[model samples]
Target: SVTGNRVAHTANIDRIAARGATFHRHFTPNQICSPSRATMATGLYPRHHGLWRNGVALDGRLPNLWQALSLAGYATKGVGKLHFQPLLAPVERDMPESLAYWERPGCEDWHGPYFGFDAVDLVMGEANEATRAGHYAAWLKRNHPEVVDLYEPDANPDSRAQDLNEVWKSAVPPELHYTS
Candidate 1:
């Protein structure tokens, strides 16, 4: 099964179309992770939310989906990549630090416990660094061994023998779950 962009290209597009819904225009507030994710969480366009670039922290005063869901008494759990933060802030830093970047510091740590989500499997600002740790690459190796060699930078036998942990595959499924 494909995930992210691959799924967008193959399954997600067709699946949306199959439901008699047209896949119309889409736009991201920012091309980078932190800003785009802030837009999604806060339900505000980038200009209004002010997370215009990568490493920018989300303005905490803005009400995000989690808070809204919590107010509505829905169990709003967050998982995977929620890239909200002040530009260049790390996970450990809290509100005071965030206020330096933002005029109002609301949700200082995007991945830390916030709103009312009962459970969250979150990764903070470091997307690229996490990917290099080999979770996805390892899952790809186990599930699609045939193409493993194709991804190698060189033909060395030792390099090709790298094994990734199977537990990493236990994360979310590659497909989006929709409820009618």
Candidate 2:
């Protein structure tokens, strides 16, 4: 974890922690991203938030921290992988966080107000090429089309041969990485 005492190569994360706050005794409502993030936003357990698992959407009607902050006259913005909704659900569901919505006709114009955020700049998933879908992808396509194709899994054929099946080095250069 980024907050681990002996963790290395997390200077940026550490700086943020220093500037604000870090939890020493953290308790999570769910193990996964969506449910956990929802818990943080709504200050409610998964059952109360109506998002018990990954693919389920959080009920928009529920009061959340972002909305509360907005109502309190703060501008709320989200960046990167919010994961508040399914990244691969059907497009008809109107899940703006999903790749389906990001691939639509005018998705490039979408910046947010989504799920109580006044504005958002989203990236749907991790650095994996297959899941590269959102504003970041659009920016990459527009500005670095030459290397975008290299992000595909097959671009680095040896990536899948690692001892840990889920571990693979991406062919996308560090300079072009989502976190870059």
Candidate 3:
């Protein structure tokens, strides 16, 4: 579906692809999001990257594309959902700063040579849940506080993976959505 029929909202895609190279056959190492993304970031299989599932944590020892980009002085930056880590985990009340959360409160300040990116504006969740927290939310909160409520919060923290099309439809307006 990357190409074929064009929608009114994505006419620019056709225009751009017409001006550029097009790929007819491309495939990912894995089918799922997190593992696939891990493979993409490292240019290695999920087994080699050691993050074979959604909730798995990627070890920092491995070389990722962003780290390489940063090392090359490219001013590495990610402007959208970078699901580099797990979303949900058991929270210990003792450790206030566990790495369980990706789009947490202070994560906007974490520009990195750490992951290979010098600056990032990430949003991982799908549809309505994309507004949970990230650079987009932080920017919305800082620049447009009055419209913050329009981007609906994730009501169910433990909501299992399923089609939530109805829920998403009843969620935020596109103009108010804060995902980068």
Candidate 4:
């Protein structure tokens, strides 16, 4: 997410923020992504929402923004890293976001209606080079199979950031990225 105060590098985000509103003083009950997002979606604290950590699922029974909007006749679609459920759960758990589920026989047709989303195009993590699963992975495999190997962090043999194990400049073009 682009910070409101740091808009210089994010011209597109700045333009969107200019038309609406941007918050500078934001408070979060949970510091982690899943719990914090669950808080925002459910309007409840992490304890109440039942997503205390990253590898847990947010209680689907809880009221959420998507459910509210859907009830009001708005079709809700989620794209990218919506970590409502564990991304590495067991295959038997049937977690749509998990790599285990993606390896299953009939998982190809599964696209949507999860976590109050009428449709979804999900990615597990920000770095598609490493966490290659979900809709983005499928799309990449089907459309850009040749480029798939280039997405690996170490694919760029000249990259200095490879040893850092945190960040790296991917050989894949920016337009091919999941976030793009």
Global lDDT scores for all candidate models: 0.48, 0.78, 0.61, 0.78
Worst 10 residues of 1 by lDDT: 164-173
Clashing pairs in 1: 55-87, 56-85, 56-87, 57-85, 57-86, 57-87, 60-106
**Candidate closest to the true structure, highest TM-score:** 4
Misplaced by over 4 Å in model 2 are 1-11, 14-25, 129-131, 152-160, 168-171
Candidate 4 per-residue lDDT, tens place, 1-37, comes to 2563421245467678879998879888988999999
Candidate 1 runs further than 4 Å off: 1-22, 86-92, 95-112, 124-128, 131-180
lDDT of 4 at 128: 46
Deviation in Å, model 4, residue 88 alpha carbon: 1.8
Q: List, residue by residue over 36-112, the lDDT tens digit for candidate 3.
A: 97898898998899988876777778888888877887887776666666656545421111234433456667654
TM-score of each: 0.50, 0.79, 0.68, 0.83
Cand. 4 Cα-lDDT: 0.78
RMSD per model, one decimal: 10.2, 3.5, 6.1, 3.3
Alpha-carbon shift of residue 124 in model 2 (angstroms): 1.3
Q: What lDDT does model 1 reach? A: 0.48
